[model samples]
Each structure stands twice: as structure tokens, then as C-alpha cells.
Target: MSRASPRYDRRVRLYDTYTRGLVELPPPPGPIGMYFCGPTVYQRIHVGNAIPFVLPLWLKRWLELDGYQTKLVINITDINDKIYDAAPGASAKLSTDATAWYIEDTGLLGLGRPDVEPTAVETVPDQIRTISALVDAGHAYESDGDVYYRVGSFPEYGRLSGQNPDQVEEQEPNARKEDPRDFALWKANKPTEDTWWDSPWGRGRPGWHIECSVMAEKHLGPEFEIHGGGLDLVFPHHENELAQSRALGHGFAHIWTHNGLLRFGGEKMSKSVGNVVSLREALDRWGREALLVFFLSGHWRKPLDYTDETMAAARAQWTDFVASVYDPSEERPARGWEALAEALEDDFNTPEALAILHEWRAAGQLELMKRGLSVFGLEIERVEPPAEVNVFKEARDAARAERNFEAADDNRARIEEHGWTVRDRPDGSVLVPKP
Candidate 1:
């Protein structure tokens, strides 16, 4: 298979968790195929779930703008223990409803959607065939109506997770399992489970790991450039996925790119941890712009603490960006664009890119600011206000010039009543649509 040459001659390097070092990507307009593991549709996803969603979308945006033809596939795990436990007999309905909510809430972020969004339930047949292949190849077995992957049979089993096969802790201990460390490839439908798909092993559902392995290959083929998800998936989930795909003579993901988890206070925010802040809540409270700025404030590969204070800071920063965009100042650092490219190229270091963006803003680089912010979907546009609103703004400016503080305040209130606001900048006051 031949890869495409770079149209813009741009390249990016990412820290592959599997390789434990930096890895340069193939050249662009690569038609680079990347897979991302999205959330299980058990309930409303938290702001933490948005990290993997946002990071990869931004990466795609950046790469495509830099001349890469990229295919980004984010999968929804509709069949999981969490979904079954969260809704029991009505799990299918919950998965359907929750999947819609997941789409709606993440869609609010305004980052472009993935090229393909595959669902786990839709890939059951492929999963069953892969499991059968593993069984025939002596890498898996059927026991008690369940299928388990043979951990010791695959010599490279723990290479990705850095866990010794012998010392690996029990995943799901079953007396019928060939080894305690072996994990399920197919889980036999329990009395508690209402959703079941028939396979050679019996009426069962695909294991979480196998679902990803099948869905990823179904869309991106056996060998793809990158597989992405939250940093926490490095253990059993990704390791098991890697083992399953490779056992069938597939190369699997060349780079395991895991974005850092979003933490609340000092702990990871998860429904299990009970510190979850729903994405809907965050979008409603802080809005999409502030939430995006908050995401950009931290490097994608590092933990970012979610706090009211941090959100407030992001809001303030977004306000400044909005104001800075319309400023007429032409002064800009000569290396501004180069600096941004260098930062992102080094390892998709968004935090560094953001810092350079602020420098562009501080130096009054309006065009540069627009170019950079567009990469992250922070769209800024200059709009002409209604004639009546402009009249109020003009009145406000006149009152301020004449030292009529009372009249100035009244004009400000009038401007707000018209659903617009005045932003006072160093150049002068400007009319902006209220955020």
C-alpha cells in the first residue's frame, strides 16, 4: 500500500504511548486513517469524555488545513457492561437515547464531526468472525458459552501495556477460562442481560475490546496510522484490543495516541467516580467558546483540572480574543505563524500554540489571530450592528467624551437591551454581539 505525498510538505510528530517516544507521521495529503474510541452510550457523557472527542477533531482540522486528507473515525460503544447495568432490560432504548444526547451535546462544541461514527452494536457479525478466527488459530477458546483470549499464547500480549504476562493481574476470573489473566472475547448473555447476539459461543455480546478491534478494522483496515482514546485506556482495554487484532495477523494501530484525562478537583471525572460534570452542564454554564479555551489551556497529553476558577479564566480569555479579533492594530511578530506551526508540529502541543496565539493577540495580529483560532473552531466574525444599535453606541461614545458618566451608562444599558454589547479596547470601544 502506497501512502500519499505531502501537498503542503507539512509533517506532524506525536508521542506514541506504545512506542514510549515521539513518532513522526507519514507525509500529508496522506489519506491518513485514524480511529478514536468514543464513550459508551450508558448515560449523558461528562466533560471528561469530550477530551478525546475534541482533541482528535482538532488534530484532524489542523492536519487537513496543513494539507492532509485525513479520515477520522470515532466509535460509540453501545453494547457495554455499563450500558447493561445502567438500564438493565431497557438497555437498547437507553443506548439509543444516550447516543443521541452524546451527539447533540458534543455537536454543541462546534468542532467538526468525525468522517465516520461507527457503533459497536452494528459490528457484531464482524466481531464474531474475528473471534472465530482467533479460536481456530489457537489464540482463543470457547468455555461455558463464553470466548476468552489466551493471554500466554500471544507472546507480544503485554508489550503495549508493559505488563508481564505471568504477573498480569486477573481481568475477569472464570474457573472455565484457560488462564485467570485471560480476558473475554465474547461474554455469554447473563440472566440480567436483555440484549444478546448469537455466535458459535452462544447467545452473547462482543467484549468491549473486541468490539473496537472489529469496528476499527471494518472502517480503517487492519493497519492504520493511529488509535486514540483517553490516557486511562492504556491498560486492559487497549492492550486487549492490540492483542486481539495482532493475533489474527493484523498490524493494528501503528501509534497509540492517548489524550490526557480531564480531572475534577484532584480526581479523574467519571460517572463511576461520581465527580462527573455532564457535557450539557458545562456547555450551558461556560458556553462552547470558554469550554474550548479551557481545553486549549492545557496540552492535550496532560491532565487538566476542571474548576469554576479555570472556566472563569477561560471565559475571560475568550472575551479578550473576541475583542482582539476586531482590533485594527496591524503590528504582529514576524515569527508568529512559524511559531504556531512549530508548536503543533513538535507534538500537537496545543498549549504552546495557544500561548503563541495570545502573543499574536497581544501584538495586535488580527489576521494571525483569526487564522489560528479558526484551526480550533473558535470562529470570530465582524458583524455590522443594526442602525439603531449603532446610534446607541455612538451616543455612548459621545457621552463618555463629554464626561457625562450617567448618560454613558444609560447608552450602555440601551445597547445591551438591543442584544449587543460594547467592548472597550485600547484602540477604542467596539460594538460586539453579546456572548
Candidate 2:
């Protein structure tokens, strides 16, 4: 395939409507502006929490690979309903403090760090400013220190989620809204939790949905490129974000991207389900690279099943790539990395990208494999090669005959380098790496 073609120059479609049935999705004219929903700092992020990270990271990398500059902003919701509930046992001083801990933990868990990591609390002033502007514009109201978006003010409120506002009004009468479909722009805080600056309504903090809208506007500008998060958040979260930004007469994201959930045994991996896998445990087991490799193997928009066996296979695959890289018979290059580039350009299709890499490795195009893998954060190196038992047997016999302990140890290393891992047996003999 010729690397330069008119079709190859087209913009990649990172967002689609069918996921949540969003409309008005076209690629941005300039750089792709992206905002992803980040973790709330209530608890250690689980493996399920990692699905969102993997998808966006790939999208960001693919955009750059496709020659489009990207500004990726991930907002941390420091203050939220969940954070308030979790604050009782929190040792941190501020909501931002707790959120920072979670962000650090996420990086440790092998989620590729975001370019601009902003927190909700840090942008409270901006959030207040946005709410104030909406109030001034008659799109929001102060109801006893609680600011709510006027769903009636925004006629296209339910368009993003494809839900009829009237239907929601009928079903959710007990909803926390002025109009049953109207969502909160700011929530009045109580004495027990974090409180904020005074608003026309009262002294309180920002709402859940408003945090992202304000943050995205403040950083990425009113009209940006891409907005993405978990599929679960598409309803009230992204929908409200879109309405709030657009109702203010500023451009919201041109396209919205979302990733599917990571399931456990056919059920969502939630704490209540008792299938919650901690990010710490997964990192400790697979290391960061293997965990990423495992996650990126599946399509971002597809539901992924996690299990012990699946992880083992990902590890094996990663180890093979590393071993191949270490092969002294091969040489690596830089320019011809377009094989993987094309795969990524096709909607960030990581599975196809990975297949191209495997094919390149098989054909001894080691440079291309190494280059493509580097861009995707999958570079593997060999400290030592796997050992061979036959070589070990030869070295063992020679060592026993000459009583040369040093030569025996050297040969043991050789055997270990070939692939068979060596273990010291009960009889003071070494066991080689098997399978």
C-alpha cells in the first residue's frame, strides 16, 4: 500500500452517533479538542474504570499518528455526590486532594496519563462563572442556592441522549429538577461536606454535569473537537454537558466519543456486584505494559470480558513481542512505520493495528514492528533470552565432569536465555524454563 494517498489524508472519525445516537457530529476544522471524564477520588479505581482511559489514550495517539494535533483534557470530578459520600473516611484536606491521589493511582495502574489533567475543584471559579453567565442569559436559575439548568430554556435538551423530555418528565416526577428533565448546574452544599463561594442562590459547590461543561469551555474553548466518556455517562452527563454549553450559544464538542464497559462474567464490574477488580492488583500482577496490551487488544467501543485466562494470554503475547525485539538477528527502522499507522487511522482500530504488527514481526520487519509498537506504548526489550534445557544439559554434564561451578552457572544462564526459566531443584540442580 502506498503510504501517501488522498483517501489516507481524510480525518479519522473518532466519534459516532449510533453509540448514544448523538447528532451534529463532524470532524473539527482545526486541531481535535478532546475532554474525557476522569475518575472521582472516592476509592481506588477499578479495572472497569480503566476502560475509559484505554479508549481515549488510543484515540489521542491515533490522531497524532494521522497528522492531526490533539489537545486532550481529562477532568477530575473532585466534588460530586459520590465524593461527598466517600469524604467521611477521606484523609485528604480538600476534594482536589483526594482526587489527586486517585489520579496518581490511575497512572500507577498503567492508564496512559492525560495531557492536561484538570480537577473540578480547581476550576470552581470557572464553573461559577459559567453558571453565572447562564443565569444572566436566562438559561439557568438560582433556587435557594441550588442552580439548575432550565430544560425549558434549552429546547434541544434531550436530543443528545435521544430521550423525549416529556417521557422523562412523566416517569421521573420525583426527580431533583425544577422541570423534571432539567439537571442541576450547581448544588447547594451542606455543613458536612465541602462548601464553596456564594452564588445568587447561596454559598455552595458546582453540580456534577456542570463541572465538565465549565472545564471543557475554560480549557478547550466553547466549541472544541471531541468529548468522550463511558457509555453509562451518555445519558444525563454528556447530554447535560452538551445542552449547557450549547444553550449558552457557544459551540460544544463537534463530535462525542464513548467507550463500552468492561464486563466480568457477563455482568458489569461494580462494587455492588462483588466482581470489582482493583487497579492496584492488576498492576501488581501484569505490570503496566501488559495490562495496557491486554486492554488495547479489544476494540474501544466493544464490551470486553476480563478473566485470569485472558490476562495470561495477553502476557504471553506481550512477552513474545519483547522476545522478538531482543532477537540480535533483527534490525529496526523509523520511517516505514506506516503499516501500523494505517491500522490506527481506521477509527483507532487497535486490533487491526496489532495484527499488522504481528504480521510485520513474522516477516522479520523488525524495524516497523519496533517503530509502530513504540508509538502505541508497547515497546518490549529483553534483559535476557529464555534458556534451553538441551543447552543446560550439555553445560550441566561439562560442569559435573570438570567440577567447574562457574562454567555450570554460565551454562545455566545460557539455558535460561533460550526460553526455559531455570529453578534450583531440591537436589541442588537447576530446573529450566518450560512453556
* Candidate 1, number of clashes: 1
Per-residue CA lDDT of model 2 for 1-435, tens digit only, reads 444666455545554643543343234334778888988777778887877776777677766665567888987777777866766545235465656656776777443787888877788888888888999999987776677888888777677777776664332243456676666788776776654667667788888888989888888888887788888887888888888888888888877777888888778999888998877788888877778778878888788878888788888777667656533224444335665666665667788887877777766687677777777666655453323465676677679669998887787667756665544434544442333
Among all candidates shown, the one with the greatest TM-score? 1
Considering only N, C-alpha and C atoms within 3 Å, which residue pairs clash in candidate 1? 6-28
Model 1: ten consecutive residues of lowest lDDT: 1-10
**Candidate 2 all-Cα RMSD:** 5.9
Candidates in order: C-alpha RMSD to true structure: 2.5, 5.9
lDDT of 1 by residue, 8-55 (tens): 355689999988999988876777889999999988999989999998
In model 1, how large is the Cα lDDT of residue 270? 70
Displacement of the residue 279 alpha carbon in candidate 2, Å: 1.4
